[model samples]
Target chain A: MTANRPLILLTNDDGIHAEGIRYLTIAMEHVGEYWVVAPEAEQSAVGHSITLYDPIKAHEISKNGSFYGYGISGTPADSVKLAIHSLLPRVPDLVISGINNGANVGINVLYSGTVSAATEAAILGVPAMAVSLAQKKNPPFQWVVPHVERLALWLLKFGLPPGVALNVNIPAIPPEALRGYKLTRQRLAKMRESFEEREDPRGNRYYWLSGEVPIEESDDSLDATALNDGFVSITPLFYDLTAHSHLQDLATALKNLT
Target chain B: MTANRPLILLTNDDGIHAEGIRYLTIAMEHVGEYWVVAPEAEQSAVGHSITLYDPIKAHEISKNGSFYGYGISGTPADSVKLAIHSLLPRVPDLVISGINNGANVGINVLYSGTVSAATEAAILGVPAMAVSLAQKKNPPFQWVVPHVERLALWLLKFGLPPGVALNVNIPAIPPEALRGYKLTRQRLAKMRESFEEREDPRGNRYYWLSGEVPIEESDDSLDATALNDGFVSITPLFYDLTAHSHLQDLATALKNLT
Candidate 1:
C-alpha cells in the first residue's frame, strides 16, 4: 500500500481543528501522504475570495513532534492557493476540499468556500474534488470516512479532465444505508432568503440573514434531488461561466449599440 | 424624463462614497430612479461572501438633505442581499454592480466582489450587470460615464435572459480612444502567483500574495483579447457550473464503485 501512494493536498472551509477535516485526513492517511492546509476559522460561505489586500500568515502546527498542518489566517481558497504556490514541498497529485460538516448544493454552491477550495486547485491545473456530507449540522464522522476514502482513491486513479472538478455530496446516513451514487447537475433553485431586523439600544438598526427553506428542484439529474433520495451525488463542475447558447442572441441585441 | 423610468438598484464592492460608484450613480441618474446599497468600506476581492455569523448594520446616509444610499457593514454580496430582502421598496427592475476601479477579467472573476454582487442579484431573479473600468489604478471616471449610460439604457430596453448577467469591462482610455464593444468569453488562464516573505520585528514571518504576468488565453472571443484590443468586453456569465458534456463519461467512470 505504501509503494505507489499519490500525494494529496487536503483542505476545508472549516478550520484545521474541525472534526470533519480531522476525519478526512485520517481516512486519507491510508490512501496517500497528505498535506493539510486549511483556514484557521470557519469560512463556510466565503466563496472564491482570495487575500489580496493583506499579508497572510501560515502557522505550522504539529502533534507529538510530527508534521500536522498549516493554519492559514485566510479563506479556504487562500489556503489552497498558498499551499500549492508556497507551502507544499512539491505539486500534489490531487487536491481534496472538505468532507464538510454540512452539504453544499443547489445555487448555494456559489457561496461555498468548501467548493471554492477545490475550484481554486482546479484553476491552477490540478485534479480536484470537494466532498460534503449532507446535513444541516455535523454528520457522523465514523460514517463518512469510507465514502471520502473511496472517492479520493478513485479520483487519483482515474484523473479528472482539464477544467473540471468533482463536487461530491454524500447522504448523512451510515455507509450501508447509502443506496448508490449518480452523476448530477447543480440545481436551479436557491434559498428563499429573508432577514430579521432589530433595533439597537442606541436606536440603530441591524439585520441578520436567514434562509428559512430551500426551493428545491425536482429533477432527478440535479444534485439536490439525488441527495434527497439518499444517493451520493457527484456533479462535475467547471469554472467556465459563459452561457454559450446565448452569445449569438446577445450579440444581436447589442449590435445597435456600437 | 423621469416618467416611466426603469427602477435600478446600484451596488459596488467599493464603499458607497468611492468615486467609482459615485460616478456610476451620477451617470445612471438620468436613465432611472436608482437605490444605492453598497459596502461601507473597500471589500475588494471578497468574492461572494455573505455575513452569517454576525449581525449586519446598514446606516442610511443622506446627501444634500436627500436619500443617498445605505452603507452596509458587510461584503458587496451582503449589501445586495440585504437591500433586496429588507431595504428596497420593491423588487428592482434592474441591478448594476461596480464601475470597479480595476479589471475583473480572465480567471480572476472568481475572486471579484464586483462581479459577485451582480451575480447575487441575478440569483435572486433580477436582471443584473457588473461594469468595470479596467485599470490597475482608478480609471478616469469622467470618461467612463457615457459608456455606462449607453449600456444601461440598452439593457433597460432589452431585458437580459434569466439567470444570465453581463460582466462588462471597459478599457482605461478616453471615450474617444474606445474601439467599440464585443461579446466575449471569460479566459481560461490564471495568474502566475508568487509570495514575498517578510519578518515582523518579533521575528514572526508572513507572506504577501502577488500575481505576476497573466497566463493569457489566446482565443479571439475571450474577454482578455477584447480588452487588449481596446474594445469593451461584455462577457455573459451565469452561476450554473455543471460540465454537461462530462456528466455521461463521469457516470460511466463511477459505475463500478456502487
Candidate 2:
C-alpha cells in the first residue's frame, strides 16, 4: 500500500526462512516495496491446496529492514490468500512467488506449490510471476537475483494481460554460463515418479516416493528443454483448466446420452 | 483390461470409506469391472500433489462383495498414480475420481484433490471423469447414481479426447426433482477464505481456516450457475495450463528485456 513505490507481495513454497524467499525478498527490494508471507514449513508438492478443515495461523516474523512479513502454518495458496485478503492493507500491484529451490517446468508445474501461488494471485486479478532455479543442489540464487530483478521491473513497467502469469525457470549455472532467456511453452513431459517399499520395525511396509527429473533433450519451444540447455525459460500460464478444443466433442457426446 | 466389460478405476479425495466412492463403485460395477485405490484419510483440497517427502503405505481394505480396494496414505493423485503404475494388474480403460462429498465448481477445482486425481489419469492418456454432488449438507448420492452410471457408460463408449476429462456435478435433489444436465463452462468465482485467529492453552496463537462459498448468481453457461438452478453441471477440463491467447502479447512485451 506504499504510495512511494509499487508494492510487491512475495511468497514461496519453501518455508519463510528458506534461502530462496530470503534472496527473493532482497532482489525485489531493489525494484519495489515488498512483503514476504510464505508457508511456515516446506510445502513443496502441495499444489493449490487450501486449509479448509484445519486452522491456519499467521505469526509476524521480524526482518531487519523495511521488509514486513508473516509466516503461515498452511500451504502456499493459503499463505497468498491470507496475505492478500487479510494481512495487507491494500491490493498488491504484483505478486511474485519463489526463487524456488527446484525448477517448476513441464507437467511438474501442475503439482508445484511455487506456481500455484502465482496462479492463485492471477485468479484474484493481480499480475504475478513464479520464479524457480533449476538445481537440486545448492543453487546460485545470488547469480539469479539480477534476472529476477529485471523480470520484476519489466512486469511492473508493462502489466501482463488479464488472467496470465509468467512461470520462469532459470538454469542453475553461474551468471556467466547463462544463455539469456527463452519464451517457451510448458512441456507435456513428467518426472518418472517411482516408489520404494520398505519395511519398518514392525514388519509393515511403507513406500518412499522418489522420482528422476526428466533429462530428455527437447527443443527451444519447451521450458525444461530451454532450461536444460542453460537458458532461462518463461512460460505464460493461465488458470482456465478447460480443454477448449474438446468442448465441442464433449458437448456432442453428452447429447447422445439424452 | 477385462474383455467382457470396460475396466474403470475409481478414487476419491474423501478417503476410501466415504459413501461417495462406495456409491460410485456400485454405479460403475453395473457398467464395468472396477477397483478402488483411494486415500486412507480425507485429503480434500490436496490438489494434484504427490507424496514426495513422506513414505506412503497401502493396505488392502475389503468391502463386502466385489468391491475390493486398496487404501493408500497419500493424496488422491498419488492414489491414481500408484494404482495405474504399480497396484493394478492392468491399465484401466477409464479413471473416475469422486462423486466427491461436495461440489468442485469454477475456480475451486484448482484446489480439488478430487479433480486432481482425474487430471492425473488424463495426463497419462486415460479417459477420466470427476463426479461430485453439489451439496454441502448430506448429499443424496443414491439419486445421483443413475447419472453417474450413464455418464461413465457414455465416456467409455465414445472415449474422451486426449488430455481431457469431464468434471460432473449433480444437484442434491431427488432424481425426479433433478432438472436434467447442462454442459457448462468452469466459472470465474472463488470462495472467500478467512482465518479465525485463536490462542492455544499455552497462549500460543493459531488460526482456523474457514470460508463462505460464493453465492453470486451467474449465467446458465457457468457450472455454478447451472448447479444452483438444480441442473447437472458437466465441465470439460484439461491438464494444459498455458494461457495460449496471451503468449503473443507477453512475448512482445518481454522482447525489450533481451
Whose DockQ is greatest here?
Answer: 1
lDDT of 1 by residue, B1-258 (tens): 124768888999988988888888888878888999999999998988888889999999888899899999999999989999899988888888988988888888888999999999888888888999878665787888888889888887888889898999989987777889999999977788888888989887788988657976668799988998899999999899998888888888897666
The residue pairs found clashing in candidate 1 are none
Q: Considering the two chains of model 2, state its CAPRI-style docking category.
A: medium
Which residue pairs clash within candidate 2? A56-B207
Please tell me which predicted candidate would have the highest lDDT against the true structure: 1
The parts of candidate 2 lying over 4 Å away from their true place are: A1-3, A63-68, A211-217, B64-67, B191-193, B196-205, B209-211, B215-217
The ten-residue window of minimal lDDT in model 2 chain B covers B209-218
Candidate 1, position A164, lDDT: 92
Superposed on all Cα atoms, model 2 deviates from the true structure by an RMSD in Å of: 2.2
True contacts kept of 2: 0.75
lDDT of 2 by residue, B1-258 (tens): 346778889999999999899899779868988889999999998978988888888888886665479999999999988888778878899999987878899888898999999999988788999999977678888887888899888887888878888899988888777788888888876567566777889887777766666758658988888998988998988888888888787778778898
For candidate 1, what is the DockQ?
A: 0.81
TM-score of 2: 0.94
